[model samples]
Target: MEVNVIFSAILIFIIVYLLFSLSGILFPIDRTWYASLKKPSWTPSGKTIGIIWAILYALIALSLAIVEYKIGLKNTSITFMLLWVINYLANQAFSFFEFKAKRLDLAFLDTAVVAITTLLLIFATLQYSVLAAILLIPYLIWSTIATLLAWSIYRLNK
Candidate 1:
């Protein structure tokens, strides 16, 4: 691989992880508070959630680079851009809604939006690169799970 491509991937990785990290920085998880709330019996441990997100974020960055390279970001359609942006924002919003604002209902809604946009994003990326689209499957699956978990938490806590 060209050094430029390597650098591009690294840059994307940093930017993608930074978004997730920024949410953490701003609204760091309150383990005590979270533990006090009623969660589904099936809820994953904190360490497992961290590991899953780390992997998912890496896949997300890779998918983004692949799609951008295949289609050229300059030539990417507005629909793709919109879906990607919306998904990014909605994904980040979960931390704020759930941790900072302590609003389980909003977090559940945000997760739904994230899942919907992620599905649309996968469809949009298919036109550019099937691999890129495929890379997002884990994220979509996780987001759907997250939506369900969020709803469950809201119902149990509220």
Candidate 2:
């Protein structure tokens, strides 16, 4: 890849990271409310969640950058772009549902949407760039875990 492509990838990653971070801020978690709920013994600490999400966001940005670079933005199919937008919206909805609204049921639904969109994204990217699809595997796996975790929490608390 060219130096410019690398820079663009990094830039895209940063921008997406910032947008996700903004959701965290807007839907700030209520620590007391969160702690009061019954959680799985294996649930990770706040620091751990932060670290993991940081890594995941970095991967997501890189995957998108790779696809854009390999296929070019103008040439990218409308379906591909739509899938990405859906994924992003669903991702943001999780924070709003779980943290801001304190609605686990809605959060679970949001996570499900995210997982589905992510899978579609993987398949869509594969048609254009295998490397991009490969890069998203971890994200899809993590989203699956997140979806299950949310469901478990909802079940336990309810």
Candidate 3:
């Protein structure tokens, strides 16, 4: 990869992860509130969630970098940009609804949007970069799992 490409990837990684970190900070996970909820047995541990999100964010950054290199940012379609924006907003909304607002139902809906946008992102990126599309598969799968987990929690609690 060219130096510029590597830098672009690094920058994307930093920006994406920083946004996620900021969301977490704003929500500030309420461990006491979460523990009081009726989560499913399959729910992952806190450490596991952290590790998985870190990897997923890295993959997302790499995928975006590949897309940027294959099709210059200026050339990306408006639909693609809209999907990315929706995905980011939906992802952030989950944290706000679940941790900050303590609304599991809304959080579940937010996660559903995240999963759908991730799927759309995969198909949208496929047009410009096969590698980028492939890289997003894990994120799509993870988002699906998260949506299901959120639903499970909502069902159990409600």
Candidate 4:
């Protein structure tokens, strides 16, 4: 595909990803359960949760847009970009299913996928653009910690 077409495709992917991710804010899922769960003592406030995700997703979107604009989505960079899209969508879907369906097992799996794919994105981003890669560091670190949290939730709730 042409670089422009690829960039457009990635843009669409990102928009859809954000729209779906935003669903958590729109609908009140089992936040009560989430709250009551045995979170680490340092668990963030609900407001913090919202703000952090918003900022992270914004960074993610911006990094991707930067990659598309500067790198033109025409080389190995596209592969990295595509991986990020895959993980982004997966993360959204996992979050939705985890909360809406109350399927902790599925949520665990999906969250793990998101974590792993994000790591790949971090690695891939380094080659394409250091700035883009650095932008994802917070997300990667959070997801790594999130992986631990998700597993703990599974054990505590199961």
Model 4 / residue 8 / CA error / Å: 8.0
Model 1 lDDT tens row, 1-158: 56666667567667876775677777889889999999999999999998999899888888888765554566789998888889988988999999989999999999999999999999999988899899999999999999999999999999
The alpha-carbon deviation from the true structure for residue 86 of candidate 2, after best TM-score superposition, in angstroms, is 0.6
lDDT of each: 0.88, 0.86, 0.87, 0.72
In candidate 3, what are the lDDT values of residues 1-158, reduced to their tens digit?
57787677667767876776667777778999999999999999988998998888888877887777666666899999999989988888888999989999999999999999999999999998999999999999999999999999999999
Residue 44's lDDT within candidate 3 is: 98
CA deviation > 4 Å runs, candidate 2: 1-7
User: Which pairs clash inside model 4?
Assistant: none
Choose 2 or 4, whichever is better by TM-score: 2
Return the TM-score for candidate 3, rounded to 2 decimals. Answer: 0.93
Worst 10 residues of 4 by lDDT: 69-78
Query: Cα RMSDs of all predictions?
Result: 1.7, 1.8, 1.7, 4.1
lDDT of 2 at 86: 92
Tens-digit lDDT string for candidate 4 (1-158): 57666767578548744764675774456877676666666666778877887777777776666666555556565577688668867777766766777777777777788888988998887776788788888888877776777777777778
Sorted by TM-score (best first), the order is 3, 1, 2, 4
Model 4, TM vs. native: 0.78
